[model samples]
Target: MAGVGVKDLLSADDIDESDLFDVLSKAAAIADGKLPARTRPRMIGLFFEQESTRTRIGFDVAASRLRHHIVDISASPGSRLGKAQGEDLEDHIRTISEYCDLIVARTEHVATVEEIARLTHLPVVNGGNGIGEHPTQALVDLFTIERRLGDVRGLSVALSCDPTARHALSFMKLLALRPPRRFTLCLAPETKLSNVAAAAIDDLRRCGTIIDRVDNVEATLDHDVLSIQTQRASSIISGRIGEMDTAQKIEDEKFTLTAEKVLRNRSKTMIMNPLPRHSETDKSCDSLPNAAYFDQVRLSVPIRMAVLSRMLAGRRWAGRSPSRSQPGWPETSSPISSSLSRSVN
Candidate 1:
């Protein structure tokens, strides 16, 4: 399969269906230790402007497995940054890309990722951009779903809470590229969905997906997969912090994924979350059979390893002995990740 270049991952929509599947297929082989293990000196530069656990750690671990050097930078208030000193974002990107092979960024502004890609020669992987898109997270999430349910094409999913979640938009984008059997967005009427999210829904509809918007929790819980995302506006904005009640309509105590809902689905259903929760999903669900979010977290390492290997070790992946075992590859799996510095494996 042809490789995804620097510009192919700026947005979820930017990913080609074939290349996306190739990434995913490579991810699965890497996950099972069937693919060539990546080796070092390959570097990935990271720039983050927000707090993250999985996005940061996952990419770091993945890069380590791929044998890459990772450099991290956080654009926080106390960090010494040219941008902090009134430098333009483009200048920062230009200066950093000189020394790095790849750039991974997590910022509230999608334009930051785009600008970095435009200014730098390195591959820029979007971690999360406000309510824009979390492409890597979507990759692992889809991998977990495929691992659990066999095929996503005929499955049903209920995307609940946080209409503005970038990961949610990415997930929807992935679904549209292929599609689930049926999918529903379970969000409050007042919930703000991003333009990307709206476009993803429209794309899914065009792909013959049975997609719906539901307000009723009971109706929303009936799907085969239940994915939860945190409210970006409430988490990122200072005025919205600790205001979960106002930001989300799901009840703090009762609206959670209780054992009741899991049992009601009857058929095995999975629940997923994109970390740093603010009372939308219950903590107890972590131990349940339905919790695939942790599995999604687990797949992040190998998938990222595959991505980094493909990007920096192109000659290695190309010249290495061919493994005919990876069948029907490009249409199957996709994965990616990020860090706060230059660390990438």
Candidate 2:
């Protein structure tokens, strides 16, 4: 599987629609055990300044399955990232540049990943960065969307989430690329969308995606997919929810979904979440056939394998670093990027 253009997977916007579909296709190939073998194994670094559950384990297993070695450095003391060790990011990156072929970083600030990119020519992947983006998770979600719905084209989607959350923002950014026929935001009453969130939805409209914002979750009942998540106090403390970093939660029951609610709607809308869910999704909802969140986890390995495999293409740190413009994953060799990667106007 080849990569989508852009030097690093720092933001969802770095790759366009074709790049997303390409990675999804590669995931399918890897699942079927048809992935081509690499000439040699390389070391992959997973540096996390923030705590994680799924993403960390998922990438670790994916890297192992592909036969490469993994070098994990977490915020246990922040020493690996140089925070606890009284070292700056540049010094730490320089140390790892010699040992790793690629780096996957999760930071409290998106700027950290951008900084790592600037410090070295090595390929970098954003595990999760502030409220900015979790590009890989967004890609995994797109894969699940297609699996359940058959396709993304012309489908209606509704998102009920903390609009400023990293995972949510990345998902919206990616959805913009595929251009759903209609995109809806089912927000709780009084909950507000951030300026950056509004800008992202506007990008979808640029691709002809019809947009709507409703105060009720049921309003999303007719959409082909409903992606749900919310911000809570823990999120504020971690600073993953937004810049305000203030305590907040969308507690309105009207915004939450239950098994009975799904049964009542009976609209074939698939339910999803980037989980460790909250009150918004009742435990009862897990029993419903429409629950694809867990299945989303099931697809994580291959989605990640596809990403790791592609990002490692033509990458090595031992050799003299190449220009950042010359990406490890070859740019789309056709007109797909130029035609589909336009920025929001």
Candidate 3:
């Protein structure tokens, strides 16, 4: 199989159908100890502006297994680059690029991640850039789906998640490249998907995938795979965050899934979640035969290790080469006060 032919993992567009298949295959090979691991340990910068559990740990463990060193950094009051210190993001990125072989970053704003990539020549991996994209998780997810159900070409998938969740958007965009047999979205009735989310659905349609939108989770039980998360019920009930009335509770429950609902519907769909879950998925559903999330998280290690090895060895991915090449923003003395910096601010 060919490599993931790109300089960085910035977005889903960085990969296509063939590249995704190769990644899944490579991950499987790595898991079985059949692939060569990176020999020389390089310094990796794992920077995050957002709180995370799995993505942060998964990359750490994967680096250890592949024999790389991670320089962990996060946005906090004590952080030299954080708002508390009022340090410039670009200056911090420039200093780190000199020390690290590559950088993996997760930020509250997609602009921050893009800025980092633009400021350095070091290979950059996008680790969930706000609600914009989370291509790495998207890759792990498709790997999990294929491992569970063989091929995704003809499978039907239902997504019950925050319409703007980074992982969900990336997952749907990746799915568009392959065009599943059916794609259903279970959204809170009052929710409006972002233009990015809607664009992914349109891409699916243009590529011949069947699309369906429903307001309830149970209505999508018949799909072959259900990738779910907490719905936006609070947004529907107007202003209050801490207050939940009977009507809001009722609205929230409609988008949640339970063992009873699956059994009552007699649906054999494989259930998946990019966890750190809330009430959307009941605890009872964890023991059900259809639950695949635990295994999905477990698979994260191997997939990440595979990706790291591929990138470290200077392997080229099979995806199309980017038509445009941007090598950092042009130097200006007043760069911090520039137009680009304000957009992210």
Best by lDDT: 3
Ranked by TM-score from best down, the candidates are 3, 2, 1
User: For model 1, what is the error of residue 180's alpha carbon versus the real structure, in angstroms, after optimal superposition?
Assistant: 1.2
What are the models' TM-scores? 0.80, 0.83, 0.84
Q: Which of 1 and 3 is ahead in lDDT?
A: 3
TM-score of 2: 0.83
Model 2, span 176-200: residue lDDT tens? 7677899877654445555456667
Which runs in model 3 stand beyond 4 Å of their true positions?
A: 1-6, 75-78, 83-86, 233-251, 316-345
Candidate lDDT scores, in order, read: 0.65, 0.73, 0.75
Q: RMSD per prediction, one decimal?
A: 10.4, 7.9, 8.7
**What is candidate 3's lDDT per residue for 110-222, written digit by digit as tens?**
56788888888877888877656788888888889888897888899998887667788778878886788988888655556665566677778788887777777888888
Q: Across residues 99-139, which tens digit of lDDT does each residue of candidate 1 receive?
A: 88887788755456666667876767777765556778887
Which candidate model has the greater TM-score, 1 or 3? 3
